[model samples]
Target: AQTVTQSQPEMSVQEAETVTLSCTYDTSENNYYLFWYKQPPSRQMILVIRQEAYKQQNATENRFSVNFQKAAKSFSLKISDSQLGDTAMYFCASARGNKLVFGAGTILRVKS
Candidate 1:
């Protein structure tokens, strides 16, 4: 069985600062993809970043980036200069074969 874990249930950041959210997963497969999805108040999950087990370089998308430590089975997200619009519930997900599993998630609130 595969599992994802987000230890922090909630996190807060002041506007214009960077914040990093932690994620970890357990998997036996050597090849797979890890993802971070963000869901806002409206309840829609958005893909923030992704990393492949075969890739050594981390994935980045604008202000969103991931630090993927495959050996430790860890994948964390870094939000740069977070804005009010960045407030959302973030979920860590893993996909292998035909199965996709997600973590409990972490709610991120950006203060003004």
Candidate 2:
């Protein structure tokens, strides 16, 4: 079984600022992938970053970085230099082979 939780349901950030979105996951599988997905208003879901359960290094994509703590089962995303274009619904997901579980999501509004 796999489950994900996002403690913050909504978040706001100023332009050119930084924000962090936290996600915690629980999984019984030894090999799994943790991911942060973003879906803008009426837009398709896009991959923000991903971390393998077996990896010790966190994943980073441009201004987006993930703090993955395997022992604590925490995967948090830090967005630097946030822009209005960054406003979206961010989801924390965990996949164990064929099963995928998504968090309730955190809506991020980037204001000017």
lDDT on C-alpha atoms for all candidate structures: 0.94, 0.93
- Put down candidate 1 lDDT per residue, 16-106, tens digits, no spaces: 9999999999999989999999999999888888888999999999999999999999999999999999999999999978777999999
Best by TM-score: 1
TM-score of every candidate: 0.97, 0.95
The collision pairs in model 2 are none
**TM-score of candidate 1 relative to the true fold:** 0.97
lDDT computed for candidate 2 = 0.93
Per-residue accuracy of model 2 over 25-101 as CA lDDT, tens digit each: 99877778989999999789999898888988888899999999988989999999999999999999999787679
Candidates in order: C-alpha RMSD to true structure = 0.7, 0.9
lDDT for 7 (candidate 2): 99
> Which stretches in model 1 have alpha-carbon errors above 4 Å?
none
Off by over 4 Å in 2: none
